[model samples]
Target chain A: DVKVTQSSRYLVKRTGEKVFLECVQDMDHENMFWYRQDPGLGLRLIYFSYDVKMKEKGDIPEGYSVSREKKERFSLILESASTNQTSMYLCASSSTPVTNYGYTFGSGTRLTVV
Target chain B: EDQVTQSPEALRLQEGESSSLNCSYTVSGLRGLFWYRQDPGKGPEFLFTLYSAGEEKEKERLKATLTKKESFLHITAPKPEDSATYLCAVHSFSGGYNKLIFGAGTRLAVHP
Candidate 1:
Protein backbone atom coordinates (compact mmCIF):
# COMPACT_ATOMS: atom_id res chain seq x y z
CA ASP A 1 0.00 0.00 0.00
CA VAL A 2 1.10 3.54 -0.70
CA LYS A 3 1.75 5.71 2.33
CA VAL A 4 2.01 9.49 2.62
CA THR A 5 3.30 10.69 5.95
CA GLN A 6 3.30 14.16 7.41
CA SER A 7 5.92 15.20 9.93
CA SER A 8 3.35 16.38 12.41
CA ARG A 9 -0.33 15.69 12.94
CA TYR A 10 -0.85 18.84 15.05
CA LEU A 11 1.17 21.99 15.49
CA VAL A 12 0.91 25.28 17.29
CA LYS A 13 2.97 28.32 16.43
CA ARG A 14 3.14 31.93 17.48
CA THR A 15 2.57 34.82 15.17
CA GLY A 16 5.56 35.92 13.08
CA GLU A 17 7.21 32.55 13.64
CA LYS A 18 8.54 30.56 10.72
CA VAL A 19 7.04 27.10 10.37
CA PHE A 20 7.79 24.03 8.29
CA LEU A 21 5.48 21.16 7.43
CA GLU A 22 7.04 18.07 5.95
CA CYS A 23 5.53 15.34 3.77
CA VAL A 24 7.09 12.15 2.54
CA GLN A 25 5.64 9.52 0.23
CA ASP A 26 6.92 5.98 -0.19
CA MET A 27 5.24 5.34 -3.55
CA ASP A 28 8.03 6.87 -5.66
CA HIS A 29 5.50 9.19 -7.21
CA GLU A 30 6.55 12.12 -9.37
CA ASN A 31 3.97 14.68 -8.34
CA MET A 32 3.44 16.15 -4.88
CA PHE A 33 0.96 18.79 -3.72
CA TRP A 34 0.17 20.97 -0.73
CA TYR A 35 -3.30 22.17 0.10
CA ARG A 36 -5.03 23.98 2.97
CA GLN A 37 -8.54 23.10 4.08
CA ASP A 38 -10.88 25.66 5.64
CA PRO A 39 -14.33 25.24 7.07
CA GLY A 40 -16.55 26.34 4.14
CA LEU A 41 -13.96 26.93 1.46
CA GLY A 42 -12.77 23.33 1.14
CA LEU A 43 -9.30 22.41 -0.01
CA ARG A 44 -7.37 25.04 -1.94
CA LEU A 45 -4.07 24.21 -3.53
CA ILE A 46 -1.11 26.18 -2.16
CA TYR A 47 1.70 24.77 -4.24
CA PHE A 48 2.87 21.66 -6.08
CA SER A 49 6.12 20.12 -7.22
CA TYR A 50 6.32 17.83 -10.20
CA ASP A 51 10.02 17.05 -9.89
CA VAL A 52 13.02 17.82 -7.77
CA LYS A 53 13.79 21.56 -7.77
CA MET A 54 10.59 22.28 -9.74
CA LYS A 55 7.58 24.05 -8.23
CA GLU A 56 4.43 25.83 -9.30
CA LYS A 57 2.05 28.17 -7.53
CA GLY A 58 -1.55 27.17 -7.14
CA ASP A 59 -4.70 29.21 -6.58
CA ILE A 60 -3.80 30.45 -3.09
CA PRO A 61 -0.04 30.58 -2.72
CA GLU A 62 0.46 33.83 -0.88
CA GLY A 63 2.32 33.63 2.46
CA TYR A 64 3.35 30.07 1.55
CA SER A 65 6.24 28.47 -0.30
CA VAL A 66 7.37 24.92 -0.98
CA SER A 67 10.59 22.99 -1.37
CA ARG A 68 11.29 19.69 -3.09
CA GLU A 69 14.89 18.58 -2.76
CA LYS A 70 14.00 14.95 -3.45
CA LYS A 71 11.24 13.23 -5.33
CA GLU A 72 9.94 11.42 -2.24
CA ARG A 73 9.78 14.42 0.06
CA PHE A 74 7.99 17.77 -0.17
CA SER A 75 7.95 20.54 2.36
CA LEU A 76 5.65 23.50 2.92
CA ILE A 77 7.06 26.61 4.50
CA LEU A 78 5.28 29.45 6.17
CA GLU A 79 7.52 32.48 6.21
CA SER A 80 5.63 34.19 8.99
CA ALA A 81 2.76 32.45 10.64
CA SER A 82 -0.40 34.41 11.44
CA THR A 83 -3.71 33.64 13.11
CA ASN A 84 -5.47 33.63 9.77
CA GLN A 85 -3.22 30.81 8.57
CA THR A 86 -4.58 28.29 11.02
CA SER A 87 -6.14 25.38 9.17
CA MET A 88 -5.71 21.77 8.16
CA TYR A 89 -2.89 21.08 5.74
CA LEU A 90 -2.78 18.07 3.47
CA CYS A 91 -0.09 16.53 1.29
CA ALA A 92 -0.68 14.26 -1.67
CA SER A 93 1.28 12.39 -4.33
CA SER A 94 0.43 11.02 -7.72
CA SER A 95 2.31 9.02 -10.36
CA THR A 96 1.97 11.02 -13.58
CA PRO A 97 -0.46 12.75 -15.87
CA VAL A 98 -0.77 10.37 -18.81
CA THR A 99 -1.60 7.27 -16.78
CA ASN A 100 -2.74 9.03 -13.66
CA TYR A 101 -4.34 7.47 -10.62
CA GLY A 102 -5.98 9.28 -7.77
CA TYR A 103 -3.74 10.94 -5.21
CA THR A 104 -2.65 9.27 -1.99
CA PHE A 105 -2.98 11.83 0.80
CA GLY A 106 -1.31 12.14 4.16
CA SER A 107 -3.41 11.99 7.29
CA GLY A 108 -3.13 15.82 7.48
CA THR A 109 -1.66 18.31 9.92
CA ARG A 110 -3.83 20.80 11.77
CA LEU A 111 -1.91 24.01 12.36
CA THR A 112 -2.95 26.59 14.87
CA VAL A 113 -1.43 30.05 14.74
CA VAL A 114 -1.67 32.28 17.76
CA GLU B 1 -11.27 28.83 -15.95
CA ASP B 2 -12.07 25.33 -14.76
CA GLN B 3 -14.64 25.20 -11.96
CA VAL B 4 -16.55 22.65 -9.89
CA THR B 5 -19.64 23.05 -7.71
CA GLN B 6 -21.38 20.55 -5.43
CA SER B 7 -24.97 20.96 -4.38
CA PRO B 8 -26.91 20.53 -1.12
CA GLU B 9 -24.12 21.65 1.17
CA ALA B 10 -25.37 19.12 3.72
CA LEU B 11 -27.68 16.12 3.76
CA ARG B 12 -29.23 14.10 6.58
CA LEU B 13 -30.57 10.62 5.96
CA GLN B 14 -31.79 7.67 7.91
CA GLU B 15 -30.16 4.30 7.71
CA GLY B 16 -31.19 2.36 4.59
CA GLU B 17 -32.10 5.59 2.83
CA SER B 18 -30.75 6.18 -0.66
CA SER B 19 -29.85 9.47 -2.30
CA SER B 20 -27.60 11.11 -4.85
CA LEU B 21 -25.03 13.91 -4.60
CA ASN B 22 -24.48 16.21 -7.55
CA CYS B 23 -21.26 17.71 -8.85
CA SER B 24 -21.45 20.22 -11.69
CA TYR B 25 -18.41 21.47 -13.55
CA THR B 26 -17.33 23.66 -16.44
CA VAL B 27 -13.93 23.40 -18.01
CA SER B 28 -12.18 23.83 -21.33
CA GLY B 29 -11.82 20.06 -21.78
CA LEU B 30 -12.70 17.56 -19.13
CA ARG B 31 -9.97 14.99 -18.66
CA GLY B 32 -11.29 13.29 -15.55
CA LEU B 33 -13.80 13.58 -12.73
CA PHE B 34 -13.06 12.15 -9.30
CA TRP B 35 -15.00 11.37 -6.11
CA TYR B 36 -13.61 11.08 -2.60
CA ARG B 37 -14.92 10.37 0.89
CA GLN B 38 -13.44 12.42 3.73
CA ASP B 39 -13.97 11.61 7.36
CA PRO B 40 -13.69 14.30 10.00
CA GLY B 41 -10.09 15.36 10.64
CA LYS B 42 -8.66 13.00 8.05
CA GLY B 43 -7.55 13.20 4.47
CA PRO B 44 -9.92 12.14 1.75
CA GLU B 45 -10.09 8.54 0.55
CA PHE B 46 -10.41 7.87 -3.16
CA LEU B 47 -13.76 6.59 -4.29
CA PHE B 48 -14.12 6.53 -8.07
CA THR B 49 -13.04 8.23 -11.23
CA LEU B 50 -15.16 8.83 -14.34
CA TYR B 51 -13.55 9.52 -17.67
CA SER B 52 -16.43 10.15 -20.02
CA ALA B 53 -20.13 10.65 -20.40
CA GLY B 54 -22.31 7.57 -19.76
CA GLU B 55 -19.46 5.96 -17.90
CA GLU B 56 -20.40 4.31 -14.62
CA LYS B 57 -18.37 2.78 -11.82
CA GLU B 58 -19.48 1.10 -8.63
CA LYS B 59 -18.05 -0.16 -5.37
CA GLU B 60 -20.23 -1.90 -2.83
CA ARG B 61 -23.22 0.42 -2.41
CA LEU B 62 -21.84 3.49 -4.12
CA LYS B 63 -22.24 4.20 -7.83
CA ALA B 64 -20.81 7.11 -9.79
CA THR B 65 -22.04 8.21 -13.21
CA LEU B 66 -20.85 10.94 -15.49
CA THR B 67 -22.54 13.06 -18.11
CA LYS B 68 -21.30 15.73 -20.51
CA LYS B 69 -21.30 18.46 -17.87
CA GLU B 70 -21.69 16.81 -14.50
CA SER B 71 -21.33 13.71 -12.37
CA PHE B 72 -23.58 12.02 -9.84
CA LEU B 73 -22.60 9.87 -6.85
CA HIS B 74 -25.48 7.73 -5.73
CA ILE B 75 -25.54 6.06 -2.39
CA THR B 76 -27.78 3.03 -2.04
CA ALA B 77 -29.15 1.99 1.33
CA PRO B 78 -26.61 4.05 3.17
CA LYS B 79 -25.53 3.18 6.69
CA PRO B 80 -24.16 5.29 9.51
CA GLU B 81 -20.65 4.29 8.59
CA ASP B 82 -21.20 5.86 5.19
CA SER B 83 -21.54 9.35 6.62
CA ALA B 84 -18.79 11.65 5.48
CA THR B 85 -18.01 14.62 3.30
CA TYR B 86 -18.20 13.78 -0.42
CA LEU B 87 -15.91 15.80 -2.63
CA CYS B 88 -15.78 16.18 -6.40
CA ALA B 89 -12.93 17.38 -8.53
CA VAL B 90 -12.35 18.01 -12.21
CA HIS B 91 -9.13 17.72 -14.13
CA SER B 92 -8.94 19.98 -17.15
CA PHE B 93 -6.91 18.82 -20.13
CA SER B 94 -5.88 22.38 -20.96
CA GLY B 95 -5.23 23.48 -17.40
CA GLY B 96 -1.59 22.45 -17.67
CA TYR B 97 0.16 20.01 -15.31
CA ASN B 98 -3.02 18.06 -14.60
CA LYS B 99 -4.11 20.29 -11.75
CA LEU B 100 -7.44 19.32 -10.27
CA ILE B 101 -10.13 21.91 -9.43
CA PHE B 102 -12.23 20.88 -6.46
CA GLY B 103 -15.68 21.70 -5.16
CA ALA B 104 -16.60 22.77 -1.66
CA GLY B 105 -18.01 19.29 -0.99
CA THR B 106 -21.31 17.95 0.33
CA ARG B 107 -21.51 16.79 3.93
CA LEU B 108 -23.62 13.69 4.48
CA ALA B 109 -24.80 12.41 7.83
CA VAL B 110 -26.61 9.12 8.26
CA HIS B 111 -28.68 8.27 11.34
CA PRO B 112 -29.19 4.78 12.64
Candidate 2:
Protein backbone atom coordinates (compact mmCIF):
# COMPACT_ATOMS: atom_id res chain seq x y z
CA ASP A 1 0.00 0.00 0.00
CA VAL A 2 1.19 3.52 -0.74
CA LYS A 3 1.78 5.57 2.38
CA VAL A 4 1.37 9.31 2.65
CA THR A 5 2.71 10.69 5.91
CA GLN A 6 1.70 13.97 7.45
CA SER A 7 4.06 15.55 9.97
CA SER A 8 1.44 16.80 12.37
CA ARG A 9 -1.74 15.29 13.70
CA TYR A 10 -2.86 18.42 15.58
CA LEU A 11 -1.58 21.97 15.68
CA VAL A 12 -2.65 25.15 17.43
CA LYS A 13 -1.31 28.45 16.22
CA ARG A 14 -1.90 32.02 17.26
CA THR A 15 -3.46 34.37 14.76
CA GLY A 16 -0.90 35.86 12.36
CA GLU A 17 1.52 33.05 13.02
CA LYS A 18 3.26 31.32 10.18
CA VAL A 19 2.59 27.60 10.01
CA PHE A 20 3.88 24.70 7.99
CA LEU A 21 2.23 21.36 7.21
CA GLU A 22 4.42 18.69 5.71
CA CYS A 23 3.54 15.67 3.60
CA VAL A 24 5.74 12.93 2.17
CA GLN A 25 4.72 10.06 -0.06
CA ASP A 26 6.68 6.85 -0.32
CA MET A 27 5.15 5.67 -3.58
CA ASP A 28 7.16 8.04 -5.79
CA HIS A 29 3.97 9.53 -7.17
CA GLU A 30 4.44 12.61 -9.30
CA ASN A 31 1.40 14.52 -8.11
CA MET A 32 0.67 15.97 -4.66
CA PHE A 33 -2.19 18.11 -3.45
CA TRP A 34 -3.11 20.20 -0.42
CA TYR A 35 -6.74 20.66 0.60
CA ARG A 36 -8.56 22.20 3.47
CA GLN A 37 -11.75 20.54 4.67
CA ASP A 38 -14.29 22.60 6.49
CA PRO A 39 -17.84 22.09 7.65
CA GLY A 40 -20.55 23.00 5.10
CA LEU A 41 -17.93 23.98 2.51
CA GLY A 42 -16.46 20.53 2.06
CA LEU A 43 -12.92 20.13 0.73
CA ARG A 44 -11.35 22.99 -1.19
CA LEU A 45 -8.08 22.68 -2.99
CA ILE A 46 -5.35 24.99 -1.73
CA TYR A 47 -2.44 23.92 -3.91
CA PHE A 48 -1.06 21.07 -5.98
CA SER A 49 2.24 20.05 -7.52
CA TYR A 50 2.73 17.73 -10.44
CA ASP A 51 6.50 17.54 -10.22
CA VAL A 52 9.41 18.74 -8.17
CA LYS A 53 9.68 22.55 -8.21
CA MET A 54 6.33 22.81 -9.98
CA LYS A 55 3.16 24.10 -8.31
CA GLU A 56 -0.27 25.37 -9.24
CA LYS A 57 -2.90 27.37 -7.42
CA GLY A 58 -6.15 25.65 -6.65
CA ASP A 59 -9.61 27.09 -5.97
CA ILE A 60 -8.77 28.62 -2.56
CA PRO A 61 -5.09 29.52 -2.52
CA GLU A 62 -5.22 33.03 -1.13
CA GLY A 63 -3.90 32.31 2.36
CA TYR A 64 -1.74 29.35 1.48
CA SER A 65 1.27 28.48 -0.65
CA VAL A 66 3.03 25.23 -1.45
CA SER A 67 6.62 24.04 -2.03
CA ARG A 68 7.82 20.90 -3.74
CA GLU A 69 11.60 20.97 -3.49
CA LYS A 70 11.77 17.20 -3.68
CA LYS A 71 9.71 14.63 -5.48
CA GLU A 72 8.74 12.79 -2.32
CA ARG A 73 7.91 15.80 -0.20
CA PHE A 74 5.34 18.57 -0.46
CA SER A 75 4.74 21.29 2.09
CA LEU A 76 1.81 23.64 2.70
CA ILE A 77 2.76 27.02 4.12
CA LEU A 78 0.46 29.49 5.79
CA GLU A 79 2.15 32.84 5.65
CA SER A 80 -0.18 34.35 8.20
CA ALA A 81 -2.62 32.04 9.84
CA SER A 82 -5.98 33.49 10.81
CA THR A 83 -8.87 32.30 12.95
CA ASN A 84 -10.91 31.59 9.83
CA GLN A 85 -8.08 29.46 8.50
CA THR A 86 -8.59 26.82 11.13
CA SER A 87 -9.57 23.61 9.35
CA MET A 88 -8.53 20.05 8.67
CA TYR A 89 -5.68 19.89 6.16
CA LEU A 90 -5.42 16.88 3.92
CA CYS A 91 -2.46 15.76 1.77
CA ALA A 92 -2.88 13.42 -1.16
CA SER A 93 -0.60 11.90 -3.81
CA SER A 94 -1.18 10.31 -7.19
CA SER A 95 0.64 9.40 -10.38
CA THR A 96 0.23 11.57 -13.51
CA PRO A 97 -3.36 12.43 -14.25
CA VAL A 98 -5.61 11.93 -11.22
CA THR A 99 -8.14 10.14 -13.42
CA ASN A 100 -5.87 7.16 -13.97
CA TYR A 101 -6.33 6.21 -10.32
CA GLY A 102 -7.63 8.23 -7.41
CA TYR A 103 -5.32 9.93 -4.93
CA THR A 104 -3.99 8.23 -1.85
CA PHE A 105 -4.50 10.49 1.17
CA GLY A 106 -2.63 10.95 4.37
CA SER A 107 -4.19 10.74 7.82
CA GLY A 108 -4.67 14.58 7.81
CA THR A 109 -3.62 17.47 10.02
CA ARG A 110 -6.19 19.41 12.05
CA LEU A 111 -4.98 22.97 12.70
CA THR A 112 -6.71 25.44 14.94
CA VAL A 113 -5.86 29.13 14.80
CA VAL A 114 -6.79 31.13 17.87
CA GLU B 1 -20.39 25.67 -13.29
CA ASP B 2 -18.80 22.37 -12.31
CA GLN B 3 -20.15 21.18 -8.99
CA VAL B 4 -20.90 18.14 -6.89
CA THR B 5 -23.69 17.75 -4.37
CA GLN B 6 -24.61 14.98 -1.96
CA SER B 7 -28.04 14.33 -0.52
CA PRO B 8 -29.08 13.70 3.12
CA GLU B 9 -26.58 15.57 5.22
CA ALA B 10 -26.85 12.85 7.84
CA LEU B 11 -28.32 9.37 8.23
CA ARG B 12 -28.93 6.91 11.04
CA LEU B 13 -29.55 3.21 10.45
CA GLN B 14 -29.90 0.11 12.53
CA GLU B 15 -27.77 -2.96 11.81
CA GLY B 16 -28.89 -4.78 8.68
CA GLU B 17 -30.81 -1.77 7.38
CA SER B 18 -30.14 -0.92 3.75
CA SER B 19 -30.14 2.48 2.08
CA SER B 20 -28.55 4.43 -0.72
CA LEU B 21 -26.58 7.68 -0.82
CA ASN B 22 -26.92 9.99 -3.78
CA CYS B 23 -24.29 12.13 -5.51
CA SER B 24 -25.28 14.55 -8.23
CA TYR B 25 -22.90 16.52 -10.40
CA THR B 26 -22.83 19.12 -13.18
CA VAL B 27 -19.55 19.76 -14.94
CA SER B 28 -18.07 20.95 -18.21
CA GLY B 29 -16.64 17.49 -18.67
CA LEU B 30 -17.08 14.28 -16.70
CA ARG B 31 -13.86 12.30 -16.66
CA GLY B 32 -14.67 10.28 -13.54
CA LEU B 33 -16.63 10.14 -10.30
CA PHE B 34 -15.26 8.68 -7.09
CA TRP B 35 -16.64 7.45 -3.76
CA TYR B 36 -14.73 7.60 -0.49
CA ARG B 37 -15.20 6.67 3.15
CA GLN B 38 -13.88 8.92 5.87
CA ASP B 39 -13.82 8.20 9.56
CA PRO B 40 -14.08 11.00 12.08
CA GLY B 41 -10.91 13.12 12.25
CA LYS B 42 -9.35 11.24 9.35
CA GLY B 43 -8.81 11.85 5.66
CA PRO B 44 -10.97 10.16 3.07
CA GLU B 45 -10.23 6.57 2.05
CA PHE B 46 -10.86 5.85 -1.61
CA LEU B 47 -13.52 3.25 -2.38
CA PHE B 48 -14.53 3.10 -6.04
CA THR B 49 -14.35 5.02 -9.31
CA LEU B 50 -16.92 5.14 -12.09
CA TYR B 51 -16.18 6.47 -15.55
CA SER B 52 -19.40 6.17 -17.56
CA ALA B 53 -23.15 5.88 -17.09
CA GLY B 54 -24.72 2.51 -16.38
CA GLU B 55 -21.48 1.45 -14.68
CA GLU B 56 -21.45 -0.49 -11.40
CA LYS B 57 -18.81 -1.51 -8.85
CA GLU B 58 -19.20 -3.46 -5.64
CA LYS B 59 -17.30 -4.22 -2.48
CA GLU B 60 -18.13 -6.24 0.62
CA ARG B 61 -21.62 -4.83 1.29
CA LEU B 62 -21.55 -1.66 -0.77
CA LYS B 63 -22.36 -1.09 -4.41
CA ALA B 64 -21.68 2.05 -6.49
CA THR B 65 -23.65 2.80 -9.64
CA LEU B 66 -23.19 5.80 -11.88
CA THR B 67 -25.42 7.67 -14.28
CA LYS B 68 -24.88 10.64 -16.54
CA LYS B 69 -25.94 13.15 -13.92
CA GLU B 70 -25.77 11.25 -10.65
CA SER B 71 -24.38 8.24 -8.80
CA PHE B 72 -25.77 5.92 -6.11
CA LEU B 73 -23.99 4.13 -3.32
CA HIS B 74 -26.20 1.35 -2.00
CA ILE B 75 -25.33 -0.18 1.33
CA THR B 76 -26.82 -3.62 1.92
CA ALA B 77 -27.13 -5.29 5.34
CA PRO B 78 -24.90 -2.66 6.81
CA LYS B 79 -23.20 -3.14 10.14
CA PRO B 80 -21.90 -0.73 12.73
CA GLU B 81 -18.53 -0.87 11.05
CA ASP B 82 -20.06 0.75 8.01
CA SER B 83 -20.70 3.96 9.93
CA ALA B 84 -18.70 6.80 8.44
CA THR B 85 -18.91 9.86 6.26
CA TYR B 86 -19.25 8.97 2.59
CA LEU B 87 -17.83 11.56 0.22
CA CYS B 88 -18.26 12.01 -3.52
CA ALA B 89 -16.00 13.86 -5.93
CA VAL B 90 -15.90 14.66 -9.63
CA HIS B 91 -12.96 15.27 -11.95
CA SER B 92 -13.10 18.00 -14.58
CA PHE B 93 -10.75 20.22 -16.56
CA SER B 94 -9.84 23.48 -14.88
CA GLY B 95 -6.74 25.56 -14.00
CA GLY B 96 -4.79 23.93 -16.83
CA TYR B 97 -5.28 20.51 -15.29
CA ASN B 98 -7.95 18.14 -14.10
CA LYS B 99 -9.53 19.53 -10.95
CA LEU B 100 -11.28 17.44 -8.32
CA ILE B 101 -14.42 18.78 -6.66
CA PHE B 102 -15.82 17.17 -3.52
CA GLY B 103 -19.23 17.25 -1.90
CA ALA B 104 -19.88 18.16 1.72
CA GLY B 105 -20.49 14.47 2.36
CA THR B 106 -23.18 12.34 4.04
CA ARG B 107 -22.58 11.38 7.65
CA LEU B 108 -23.79 7.87 8.41
CA ALA B 109 -24.31 6.35 11.83
CA VAL B 110 -25.08 2.65 12.05
CA HIS B 111 -26.03 1.45 15.51
CA PRO B 112 -25.75 -2.18 16.48
- Considering every candidate listed, which one attains the maximal lDDT? 2
lDDT of 1 at A26: 97
Candidate 2 residue lDDT tens string, B24-50: 999877999999999998989999999
* Shift of residue A34 alpha carbon in model 2, Å: 0.1
lDDT of 2 at A6: 99
lDDT of 1 at A74: 99
TM-score of each: 0.96, 0.98
Tens-digit per-residue lDDT, B1-112, candidate 1: 7789998899999999999999999988888899999999899989998999999999998999999999999999999999999999888665366787789999999999
Tens-digit lDDT track for model 1 on A13-110?
A: 99999999999999899999999998778789899988999999988999999999999999999999999999999999988853345688899999
Tell me the TM-score of model 2.
0.98
**Model 2 chain B lowest lDDT segment of ten:** B91-100
Runs of candidate 2 with Cα error greater than 4 angstroms are: none
Residue A93 error, candidate 2, Å: 0.6
